[model samples]
Target: MDRKLNRELVKATALRSGYSFTKLAQEVSVSTESVSKWMSGETNPRPGKAIKLGKVLGLSYEQMFGVRDRTLEPQVAFRLVRNQDPSEEHHERAREMGRMYEDLVPFLPFNQFEAPPRLKSPTADYEYLDELCGSLRREMGLEADVPVSLPSIFNHLSDKLQAVVIPVFWGHRKNKAELAAHIYSRKTKTTWIPFNLDTKLWDARFWAAHELAHVYTFDVLDDEAGEIFSDAFAGTLVFPVPIARAAYEELAKVRLKTQKFNLIVEFAKRMHVSPICVAKQVDRYAVAKKQPPVNAEYDGIYAAISRMSKREKTVAEEFFGGEEPSVGQLLEAAANIFKSPFFDTLSKYLKTNGGSPSFIQGLLDCSLVDAKALNSELA
Candidate 1:
């Protein structure tokens, strides 16, 4: 075998198996230096060691020997659009989630799964998008001007589009850039939207709609303009133009800043959107109608909403009648794919050969505890 191909195979297997060179060496009973040489093209594993390597990494001898099969790779290709530049760790985490979803497909109890046909144009303007949203609402059996039921919309998208809507719980409160991400696999025609859960129901709902917009316009929009269009689309989908016009008319009559702030809150609650969204949409509507924007007094409105004595239930809880689903639960479900023969073989090999929990954690981008829990589940 060509040393270059050997190096590529080693590197690719390590990534797919979630093992570092040292860890790979430990699993295969080879020295770290030997594994490094194999990966660097300075040496190749002996036949006996190569077989062990394949077993531990869940690859066939042909795969390790460079007889590559395209089918063995992730069947789905994903495009990720984040609000800001993500850290390397964040990227790895997202990629791990994608891989898990791909592995779960064959095990999921469903058939004839396919993503909805892309219905958006890259060159679509606001008018085109407006008509698109209205049409989509009608297709989904929703009224043109009614406030969208966020949970109902989620369930509908999940079923109709064959997409997974997973809520990601980021424990850090200050990380604002990592809002939501949309990942799609062209090969499998699958889409997954992992949204941030550490936000108000209204904000999370907007983010969900924003990601849905990305799914519709994935190939068309790749820059700042695409982002702007997605935001507009999300706002429109949540609060349609007719509803926005009526809210604008009513909000325009208020003169006092405090009064306006209160009114904006009420409008947001009624429409199931954030007050900030209502304020911005009201401004957009005013510009369209050639009227002055409402005096929303943004800061005061946020402060007042925050200072409210009664806490409203989140949209997820309200709709589902319980706590929002957690990322751990999703991962747990994905881990069931291990019951398949390939993953079962890997699990048996690890158990018999004393595989480290870190190997599973690294491969799945999960916690040590989670890795252990998954191992027990697989057992």
Candidate 2:
């Protein structure tokens, strides 16, 4: 029929500028009824009418078009270029999140089996990610036993990976936390949240673990789904085939023996992931293996992202609070997170030092890095 526009803000935007539905319709050459339907999301707008309406409503084609920002935004697509270094502020925030990764790596329940469905990268670049983190729990064989060392762990992948640390701020004009909470990048090589939320050390690791799983999704699938596949990747990483099977077998025996494995807690201790993730992993394996999902009795899950409170550190949880709101956003935050001057300086230092130092150490060499807060405090 006609083009769609911002239904909620249509009257406000139109009224503010002495515009109205009739005027909008005239601009787009559509009937008033048609314009009403489009506003209610009942029907999509035709490209032509949609473009015309956008101007009348004082909106850009992108907003009027209603495309997901991460999926269709030009800059998001540009991130695929892999030339921009993640902002230091963002990286420092990520480093805070990295603490969680470091804590969980040690306890990760490596399955190394249940071979994940492999997909090859279609090209040198693809965007693979999504918001479903529970899926990552099952795939990674996390078993709640993993620990992530932000400083040392990420040092290994600096070459092949393009890690971005987005610092989330709260009560800081714009809420960056929401943006940082979800991620979008094209390299498929890797996008590191290094630091996210503030539940505990393990929680941060869980976020890191999830993003690390993203690295694999890009590597194997060779396409760009953003966070959608990230869930699958994280599930695979935490639950891997071997561990899933082992958990199932163990649970089966537990059922038979009328015993309690406390699988959730046990896995958490072992994998450094949250007990909640463990429970979900169990359920995933059970369902995938043709068994009943984990019982509802085991439904309560611990929040892995709550680690920030444990440290009494205000940095990670402030997904919206920051000195410079712009710098705290994802790509920009990474450059400033480690207290570095910016990516260029860090890159230069890495080039001089052979990119061998840990992420924190490298930050020390760069100028303008908030070394004190980023050091042992957040590190």
Candidate 3:
């Protein structure tokens, strides 16, 4: 279905929230003309801005579009690609999955975990975040210059923060939203994060790090600054400033663009992260050090990383084969590889409460047939 902004709903909600068009635009960092256009249905804001606008007007994305999912608890944080927003069907499916997780949390062994300390007075300052990440690296017993082990990172989230990190096969499509649903269930007082496992290993590592940052700083983050902090935190956590400085020193010696590209690719390969992560961290290091930023074509660097990632198998592919995996196999991958107890706990709950396979289908984004197999396996 062709979806457009619900102009009447936007206008009504904004008015109820005590916002004039100019005030609404100012609140969301858009112009009065743009707000008028959105209200007139002449244009629609990008997904990020639309969500921002909804937040300012006290509406959800679905509410602004006249199709609210009342079952979905308010989201603490979520990340989407710049150009692609989840379609309504995809959005609702994700929300339903999140609700299922929430329903099972009461039966899960959630109390064994503790929440991480929140950042006080969060800022997007490079040096401040760099230092914060440095402290976190040391606290986590990670060597500053070494590549962070992916399993170690996953275990940290599970053991330290009490977060349920569910890895689902979201498909290998361009412009797909990475973190579809990251909700903080008030009833359970737990955070449920489901990220795409379809991304390559390196990219998946970065995304996992990104979720870690979000869990760390959720209490202090807004939509915009939260993303900035999460990006910086993820980059610095995986490729810290010490490593960035070393890479920068090598990059400074190179004059050719190809040389700079090669140096970045090499650094990324060494760190086992995306070249984009490497490049951004290098830029942050340069800014903090008060030095001229290295010159590199970011698009070329990103394209190269994409090509390299294509060769590396995604988390799903690594665990299950290329064909569709049975629910039992998927759960095994989640439990073993992700180090997540979500399915194990849910299986216990299902045994007592007697739930349906459709819930499993929604949670794993798998077919009903696969979900039925999970019920049978549980039986």
Ranking the candidates on TM-score from highest down gives: 3, 1, 2
Which candidate, 1 or 2, has the higher TM-score?
A: 1
lDDT of model 1, residue 23: 91
Residue 192, candidate 2: Cα error in Å is 7.5
Best by lDDT: 3
Model 1 quality (TM-score): 0.62
Where is the poorest 10-residue window by lDDT in model 1? 333-342
lDDT of 3 by residue, 151-242 (tens): 77778788778888777655654434564357666545677787777767667677788888777777577767887888778888899888
- Per-residue CA lDDT of model 2 for 261-379, tens digit only, reads 36545555666555555566666667655776545134223333234225433434443353433322533544433321234433444454444323543222221244333332332
Go through the candidates in order and give each one's C-alpha lDDT. Answer: 0.61, 0.43, 0.73
Q: How large is the C-alpha RMSD of every model relative to the true structure?
A: 10.0, 15.2, 10.3
lDDT tens string, model 1, 1-379?
Answer: 2213356766876898789988988999889998988887776664446667877887766666655444423222222323356553355345445554564455433345444766645433556656877887897788966777665566555655555665444433344345566666554556666554444576766776777777676656665656777788888788777777888888878888777877777878887888777887777777766788675545566666666523655434443445644444445432331111223433565666566564555444345675676566454
Q: Which ten contiguous residues of candidate 3 have the minimum total lDDT?
A: 68-77
Instruction: Give the lDDT ranking, best first.
Output: 3, 1, 2
| Pairs with steric clashes in candidate 3 | none
Native-to-model Cα distance after best TM-score fit, residue 22 in candidate 2, in Å:
28
